[model samples]
Target chain A: MKRKYFQRKFDIRTYECDFKGQLHPLALFNFMQELASTHADRLGFSVQKLMQQKMTWVLSRLHLKINKPLRWGETLTGRTWPSGRVGKYALRDFQFFNQTGETTAVGTSSWMVIDLEKRQPLKLDQLFTSDVSLKKRALADDFPALPEIDNSENQCKFAVRFSDLDLNRHVNPVSYIAWALESLPEPVLFRHYPMEVEVSYRKEVFLGDQVICKLQQIQGTESLSYIHKLFLEKNGQEIARLRTLWK
Target chain B: MKRKYFQRKFDIRTYECDFKGQLHPLALFNFMQELASTHADRLGFSVQKLMQQKMTWVLSRLHLKINKPLRWGETLTGRTWPSGRVGKYALRDFQFFNQTGETTAVGTSSWMVIDLEKRQPLKLDQLFTSDVSLKKRALADDFPALPEIDNSENQCKFAVRFSDLDLNRHVNPVSYIAWALESLPEPVLFRHYPMEVEVSYRKEVFLGDQVICKLQQIQGTESLSYIHKLFLEKNGQEIARLRTLWK
Candidate 1:
């Protein structure tokens, strides 16, 4: 039987770290995405393979929890596996470990198979029947609808660049989190580090598009959370919404 | 004797590639920077070591030529070495090779040792005496001054985000090029690929700073060239200028 899991090791580059010498959240997300793609390719379900059938994968939502902050020059092993399915969504889970084999982060993500021509979600069971370890889940929480931001305290505008587009021709999902983080207040950004992040992608963003990120903060007894909403500047269409917790 | 040259191998990640499935220029630059830092660390001249002595290395200029475009999922070996010192500037060079050992890209960069407190350039001879093979140069051309943009044609404004800053608490040099590329015509960006790029960094950009990138095209006899200037939006301080040849 084909192995249901994939593992890849990565060395943290200096450019991947922030001023605090810790790995930036965006870099971590990039690593996860890379691992997921590689695994999908190994399973004969790569984007190219799906494209041949006029179907492509679209990330719907992701929830990541970082147990420890990864630092520069540290080598980490990323392990990912297919984690069953829910309705039209395909579930994947990821775990990141440090050099000493400590779990640094764990993530659960939901993706949808989409018909490129019709621009609609396709049923997963028809196209995706790969072996998934239904019992193994990195994160215990199921994919839930995130709360909306009550008020926006800060915001930033961004013009999508060519570099922001990936091989799929749409804006890379990691860029959304990068812009969301940028919309936070200076004190919140520099004083704290993100320990958890949940992102829900609503619409596709392309090159030459202008987007604005709106940030709203919520204070809790245990942790501080911020909700970020990214919207198309031209039509006010929602692109993505993210909730991040800092400590 | 310590090895003067450092070599590292990297697997191009899926996220690092563009719509063409070729590695992005910014990713190539990031790989070069990572290789350079690793080499410096091995030579006991890392940024941390320099910071201990109240000094730091600042990139002054760089010229990179891509003989062939690198593609996603390909393994490339990057080799970098300290070439020599020219007056107050220390010269380093880089060469990238594909799995077949074909030279894919080459770059030469100039750096200066800066006194952190005084913000002054220090003499290369005073603090740096590392073994450098003066004869080994990746590129034959001397570090030439990059041309300034004549007239602003396309422009984009950006606010420095925390993610843009590296461990040095300043904007990574690669981000400057990313912004410069964003300030170009869509046809030029999507149709042509940059074959050669030269950049001269004039001023440092920090967090919360707003900057604007202005692009100017220069039609040459054989090739099309574009000049990009990134300036501080508040005071109009020229941060960096880049010249790129696209084919």
Candidate 2:
């Protein structure tokens, strides 16, 4: 029988933690991505395996909700499983829990297989037919589409460095999340912690590329929210959009 | 008998690897930092313990020699131990090996204890005495001082992002190395791999700080060398210096 889920244990390293000694959100995303890749590998669809067929998985969207902070030196158990397909997108869900077994975060991601040479998305049905639980999901709610920011109060520009590239030779998706958060106000960044984050990746970025990040804040009754948009500076192409809720 | 050394095991995550699927030097530094911190913690000199005493350990200088490239999904065993005091500086040594027991890297680092309130360095003798291997050294050669780069051929500027800060609320030391390498030529970065690196931390950088990295290349008969200097863009204060040998 094939395993329906995969779980891995992680010990939070000191460098992976923030000023509060808690695991940074980027580290959490790395953990989730690792777990998901391992699960996919077990099902014979890893990046290495896919590369043999001139195809690779691209993370198009992800939504993560942090319920509790994972602290340094703490052990985190991350679990992920396939949640079947949604049109041309392959869906995966993740859950993170501390050693005490309390849920720390839940995340859902959408992926698409792309032809490496052609740079075009491939239909999920033609490539994968893994046994997925169509009804199981770490997050039950569907993510609302994040709108592009037009009138932005804060902006930051970044030149993609060599360190930003991963195995795909493109800027790692987590850097986009970091750039989005970097454009927020100092008060919002220092005074509040992000509780929920939704990201939609529209284009790929490469080394030596320049990008601009724009952010707009929205004050809510209970918490503060921000809309972030990242664009390629060369052609004004929107590379990614993000929505973050903080408390 | 007092324990003289500490060891830890790690599995390289996918995100930690580069385009060639080999572990990045930055990730290696993170692992080394984590292992060193854990050793200090085990010996009752961790960051938490020092912070409670209104003091903290500051890394002053480090020299690393890489013998082999660690790849994704491989198991790495890291070992570190105190090498006693060198004047006002306390020294530590590190060695990393793969599962097959081949040495992958060796490093030596100097650290100083600083009074947090006054931002003053304290004498090593003032700290509690701990038994260390004074004769054992990971790398026998003492690091030569890196000179400032006057006529730099390449330059890059970066604003300290929120993600760059660690528990000390200062830009983590690894970012300094990354910034130094970011100024190198693209061919040197992609065609060759760094074999040896030496860094000296002259000052601390905080959020909202803008820093400029300058690099000068030296062509040698056997290999290529780079001299890097990082300065505060606001005041031109030199923050760090580095020398990297690549093959």
Candidate 3:
């Protein structure tokens, strides 16, 4: 039987830490992204091959809950597998484990196969068939609905640059996460860290484009949850929305 | 006899690329940094151990020349070793090799032992000593002097964020390189990629400090070289200087 999951072990680098002395969200998301890419490639759905067909995987949603922030020099393993599909979107899940084989973090993501020529999502048959045999979900959770953020307390503009792009020439998901995290107030940033996040993508950000990020509290002061909304500074069209559960 | 050099093998990640389908300078510097730290740990002078003694290795300068930019999925190895001591600074060198052992790039850096509480420089004695059994320099290179960036055409301010810091809580070298790259205009960024860089650190940047990056072309229209000078936006105190050779 073909294995339903793939594991990649890595040692957290010193540069991957943040001001609070733990793993940066960028690093965590990057590892999960890397694992997904590698697993897809090994299963004959590599990004390069898909690009030849003018198709690419676009992350549509992500829900992650970090149990513990990894420390520098610590060894951790990321295991990811396909968690079935929902219509045109391909679902995947990830688990982070320490050297002792205990899970330390978990994440789930939804992706759409976008065709370059049509500028739309392609069907699962058009791309490549996923391993239907594997039916595992890392989280026993559902997609959280986005809370309306009526008024934003703070907003910042970002002009995408060369460093913001990837081999796909698109701004990767981790960049958006970094931008959202950076937009938060220093007090909020230092006071608490995000234990869970639900992100939804509505549009693509290209190089040289100016985008604005607005941050505000989603619910009341009862539970710490903030909503981050991103839009094009030119047209103010909503591009992405994210809600964070701060611990 | 003690081993004098350490080599780590890895492939470039998708998040590490820029506009072109090649590796970003920040990613290259990061891998080199990881190798050096790992080597130090194996030699019994790891950061954690040094921190117990209230001492840490601070990167003072780094000079790197890239013959080619690595592509995603290309396997590469980073080999680094101590070259000797340069007064209060410890000298080290690095080389990036392809899977076939062909050298793709090279770099050199100097580090200073700093007393954390005292906020002062310390001699190499305080930190555990390196093995003197081997004395081999990776390249016949010397530190480059700071270029004269008298009047800069482009200037941008970067407020040190939680993501910009490292385990040492100071802004890392790669963050400075990223800031300099981001400060360039789109035309200049897409037109030229850096082939060589020599960086010098004068002062430390802390959290919430807005550091100004001033960029200008050095020399004439002959060989492309640019100078990036960083300082506090408010106090105008010099922080770091970087000279880049463009291809």
**Against the true structure, what is each candidate's TM-score?**
0.97, 0.97, 0.92
lDDT of 2 by residue, B104-124 (tens): 999999999999999999987
Listed for each candidate, the true contacts retained, as a fraction, are: 0.94, 0.90, 0.78
Predicted structure 1: lDDT: 0.88
**Residue-by-residue lDDT tens digits, candidate 1, B1-247:** 8887999998999988888888888888999899989998988889888998988889999889999988888999999998887888888999999999999999999999899999999987767565555568999767777766667778888888788887678998999988887787888889988889889999999997999988888865578888998899999999999988888
Model 3 chain B: ten consecutive residues of lowest lDDT: B125-134
Instruction: State the displacement of the C-alpha of residue B47, model 3, in Å, after optimal TM-score superposition.
Output: 3.2
What is the per-residue lDDT of model 3 for residues A1-247, given as tens digits with 9 covering 90 to 100? 5577999897888778776557777788899988998888877787777888888888889988889878876899999998987778888999999999888899998889888888899888655644542687888555666776788999977767568777677787888888888888878777787877778998988986788999998655777888999999989898899988787
Better of 1 and 2 by DockQ: 1
- Per-residue lDDT, model 2, residue B68, is 94
Model 2: runs farther than 4 Å from truth?
none
Poorest 10 consecutive residues of model 1 chain B by lDDT?
B126-135
Give the TM-score of chain B in candidate 2. 0.96
Which candidate's DockQ is highest?
1
lDDT of 2 by residue, A1-247 (tens): 7788999899999999888887888888889889987888888889899999999899999999999877888999999988868777888999998888999999999999999999999988778665465459999756567876768988889989898887788999998998988888887778878889899999999997999998887654567888998999999999999999887
Q: What are the runs in model 3 whose C-alpha is more than 4 Å off? A: A129-133, A141-144, A220-223, B125-133
- What is the CA-based DockQ of model 3? 0.64
Q: What are the candidates' individual DockQ scores?
A: 0.85, 0.84, 0.64
